[model samples]
Target chain A: MKIEEFSSDHLDVLKELMNIAMGNATASIADLLQAFGTMHIPHLTITDMDGLKSQINHTISADEKYYVTKQLFGGIIGGEFIFVMTDESAANLGHYLYDVSQPSDADIMDAVIELTNILSSTIISRLTEELNTKVQFFAPSTQIISGNHIIGQDETLNYHKIIIVSTEMEFQSHKISGYIFILARDETITRLRELIDQKLEELYA
Target chain B: MKFLVVDDSKLARLSLIKTLKEYEPTAECIEAENGAVAVELFKAESPRVVFLDLTMPVMDGYEALKLMMQIDSNAQVVVVSADIQTQAQVQVLALGAKLMVPKPINSDKMLGILQQLVF
Candidate 1:
């Protein structure tokens, strides 16, 4: 779907949905670590592969170390849910999760997986639920890598036309922050636009 | 009458409950956060109508729908989800769900279903 096709009202719905989703994520994470957190209003973009790369690179600088986790979900619609965190932020988050000043290597890995699970369930699940559709996530996988290559390495993903939904997540107590991206495939993006249009019509008409 | 509403998100459940109350004011509403807990409540309460969410942890909606049907073949289960693909609609219907409503719930449609299916 063309991003232009979505009116301000449609984008409002998406932002509201993301706000609710990430709000839950922040609250749950806060509960787990006994820390305060903030979730920004999500931003959306309709772009191509090159544009995606440009956007991602801007979000993560070249020298930054990152933890990237991605999971595929499908049912009425299908897409990828990706979570990105810088090295410093990831370390802070890990410390909070493990409740240790110096976490073991295994502790770091486990914390990442647990955090991913909670977020994938909380954020993406809420987004889909608000859309009135169900999505089942396939297995989630992660990689620890430097920032410059995050988007460039994934050639398997269809990037012809992607709908990108992103939000900033911050844990104030731990001084940790991260980004969450939900990439709706072109087909799913088209369907989402159609559904939003339908909803708008019902509301106005 | 009693109704069981299952969704993992607290906000979603509350939204669903609001719409449900508008339609069936007298029905007592019960909530569950996941499919597994939903099944337990379904068995324990034998609610007149069940509004189910499809994507959840512990037990997803498909498994919960199947288990609820097994518990009572005549279960009046409604599938409310964001994934409203034709295949999903057919699959859930085949498994005994009465209807599937697409998300951001359409109040008029939901009320119509309450009149048709619940009564």
Candidate 2:
């Protein structure tokens, strides 16, 4: 199962799943922040490993791409969930929570962590119940990326297949984007296909 | 009993204090804006029990718990947060936190936990 082939076949279903997951996350955040906000998840697209690497390298300037938050979870559905947001986004979220009209860059890091904590937990909870499995989420790790650093590159080339789901969030009219990548083990693809098929059947039936 | 409550949000801390006061009139409560200050208060005052928020600036509840345990392993810490997910709840419990209480601080639930911990 090549990355492109898998993405082409499953992108729509993956997008729908992400929408459901993120909707719950968005609501949870709104309740926590005591502010009403809306989440808009654009179409899901599969980005090949090479494409993702290039995109990340190009989007972040060498000096600016230093910090990242990575969380991994496993259960009936297993994957490496990654959220890449600029320092600006983090501050923006924090300021929004504080009801500040304009948030300064100083506040973004804390805001980013808070937002990530709430969003990640909400998504994991939804995934656990939907998949009917005991999902475990590790503590999130913050890392510094210098220049064009690529993740999951050192592993066996066989696991290059990645499923990318992009989420855009609007809070207090401020917009931020979050990305979740489902990196499937070689044997896991068949199981995912079965799950998707079952979901489709339930949706139609 | 004396209780020290730590949370980054002023609103949340205020609400918790209000609820505690309502549930236990004689409860002497102190407040800290973040986990680090809470730890400092814990070492200085050694309150009977502490109500800690999981998310905050400077130091989060988990880090504060590690520091408090190092100071006194028998410290009683209860986590209060809006994050009620099973994974987070399990992780906090596994870390030796006495109880995981969800937010919006239902009066009955808060009183129930307090009664168990206090009495």
lDDT of predicted model 1: 0.77
lDDT by residue (B47-93, candidate 2, tens digit) is 99889876566888878988888898888889886455555577778
Scoring only the A-chain of each prediction against the true A-chain gives TM-scores of 0.90, 0.72
Chain B TM-score in each of the candidates? 0.95, 0.94
Ten-residue stretch with the least lDDT total in model 2 chain A: A1-10
In model 1, the Cα lDDT at residue B101 comes to: 84
Which candidate wins on DockQ? Answer: 1
Superposition TM-score, candidate 1 onto the true structure: 0.61
Q: How much is A198 displaced in model 1, in angstroms?
A: 3.5
Residue-by-residue lDDT tens digits, candidate 1, A108-135: 7678777877888888788777677888
Q: Give the top-scoring candidate (lDDT).
A: 1
Report the error of model 1 at residue B1, Å: 38
lDDT of each: 0.77, 0.65
Which residue window of length 10 is worst by lDDT in model 1 chain A?
A196-205
